[model samples]
Target: MDEYDFLGDVAVAGSVDSFDRAITPFLSQAFHAKSLLAIHFHRTRLPKVLFRWIPDKTLRQLFDKRYEKLGFMVDPFFHRAFLVQDWEACLLRDIAPDRFESSEYFTNYFGDTNMVDELGFVARIDNDTAVHLSMGRNQGQRRFRTNDVVRFGQFAKILAPKLRQILINQPADDVVEAQPLDRRFHAMAQARHTNISIREAEVAALIVQGHSSRAIGLKLGISGLTVKVHRRTLYKKLSISSQNELFGLLVNYVGADA
Candidate 1:
């Protein structure tokens, strides 16, 4: 079994802000890197800003120009892994390469660029969106390792649930009905579209029905710890960190009586 196999319990219950906080300190511990940053694309038609590193005005202008040249604005449902051979040329090409090269399944799209010598991953939030995450190590610092990428992927996997809970568990315009997604919450919607198993959905429904963790465990014929794990996974998948947040989101988006 893969290291993440235990996460299958994500199908049972929800509400896990404490768990999310619990795992964050390990992000740095799990991945060795010169730098790591994550930016959330909350809304569209606004500036595709960065919460982490401060870009100089000149660099910011160049980044903006790159976005315009990209032909596609950031939106949800976009996933790309990049390995850069040239940094300057990447700005010229306007395409971010996927970083996970060891996995045959994770392909790199922009290889001809002359500036990149490392890898990165970018996942957008909307079709009309202009959000992107472009993180990589310089040629000299530390070559991007598969294990680092794997750890980042794990962090992404965990972060997904929290984001999902936050988006779907509310009436926020950005969080639309799962059936007819408008492409705004593509990242969150896509997780629900795929990954979320039927058993998991059954668990979520039960949680909404006011089932306790122990009761849910009994109903599913699983242990209470298993139920607890599932609930945490669900919260992460839904972008929810707390029970109150889950209730609010379900009441707002799913029409579940709050």
Candidate 2:
């Protein structure tokens, strides 16, 4: 494909089928993405499936039904999407925390996807609305390169605004706020140790969700050093020596629900 050939067809894509025909070549040729999933997100409700394709049936069910139903509580990507409503392409590794790969969210659910890497392209619709296109690479496929992200991001920038418009013109669905994810930490900690402060629990939750102290601080309006202080205090209160222990406790406490 020439430099201008990729995503050029999207300009005439008026429907999802047309869009797929236009983008499939670029995805397979440029990024080698094995799966492409588009999700609509707003507030606390489960992410609405705009369009999704996963080759394996079990993997698709695990992600769409099971993960969205239960596993989202600990998903770093889900939390980050709502927190920032970032409208750009980002690598999953860059968004996830220092120890996210070790958490149950990674080991149990995300692991099932069998993806070597994930690249996300988000389109901001409004203050609390956005759409995310999640692209994945399987074990045999090459990971997305820098040029892939750059080119896809440029295409998404032109295409995302249309998603915004489509959403605006559509009738709004009823939205019910789900349980606040922050409280899960407090609930889990109090089951064993009652001394954990709310702030400490919040930090612990973010930590287990793969956030760095700096990322947690930015989310909580505190300094990174303060987050570290809270980490030490929380660890002490929970009688834990490391993040691995903390992740273990949360996984145990959150259990089948997660």
Candidate 3:
């Protein structure tokens, strides 16, 4: 569809629900995407999965079970959209790291997924928040062409203002705001009474806060090896094995608090 046709559809979208219904069909048709995932990023907090349209139950479960963990932190698309101020639409391959395919994030989380390619639209909702709309293609499908990216970027620019309005008008009661990971970790630790040491708690907090072992060590005036040891001890204390499990623990705590 042309830009005018797309705008006409947007014009009729009076609410968030209507906007979502209208746009997803258009995006699915226009890009030949198998699914969509919309994420809202807050400057100092974990991202909220605002909307998802994955039809495959297994893919959805994999996202919840695996990708919600440290894998997201390593995703170039997430890092760029969340950290960078400029908003634009781009293909995932265009921004991925040189060694992305060999990275643990790819091998363990993304590579196992059915998606072959992803295109993202970064829509700024406010100074501190942005909505990332991802369009995914399943395996055996062709990657996005240059003209497709250009056209999609143009469409995203046109849609941004309407998306911003929809988000701004969303009811506060309906929104589930994610608290900062470090704060949530502290709260979880306090409620557990699990004989976790202060140092271990600190390490765990930083880990959930998306800090690398080297970075945590630097912050704590210790070595990376010490940070790893503390992390292992903390995980053993909490009976969690992976970062995904730790993330699930924090999410459970947040839900209980809510």
Q: Model-by-model lDDT, in order?
A: 0.39, 0.72, 0.71
Worst 10 residues of 2 by lDDT: 67-76
**Least accurate 10 contiguous residues by lDDT in model 3:** 172-181
For residue 104, model 3's alpha carbon misses the true position, in angstroms, by 1.5
Q: Tell me the tens digit of each residue's lDDT in model 1 across 179-221.
A: 2112322223343463554555555644543456776688789
Better of 1 and 2 by lDDT: 2
User: How are the candidates ranked when ordered by TM-score, highest leading?
Assistant: 2, 3, 1
lDDT (Cα, 0-100) at 98 in candidate 1? 24
What TM-score does candidate 1 get on C-alpha atoms?
A: 0.31
* lDDT agreement of model 3 with the native: 0.71
For 25-96, candidate 3 gives per-residue lDDT tens digits of 888888898888777666655566767888877778887764444345556666567655657788988776
lDDT of 3 at 99: 43
Cα lDDT tens digits for candidate 2, 185-226: 788766775667888978987887877888899989999999
**Candidate 1 lDDT (Cα, whole model)?**
0.39
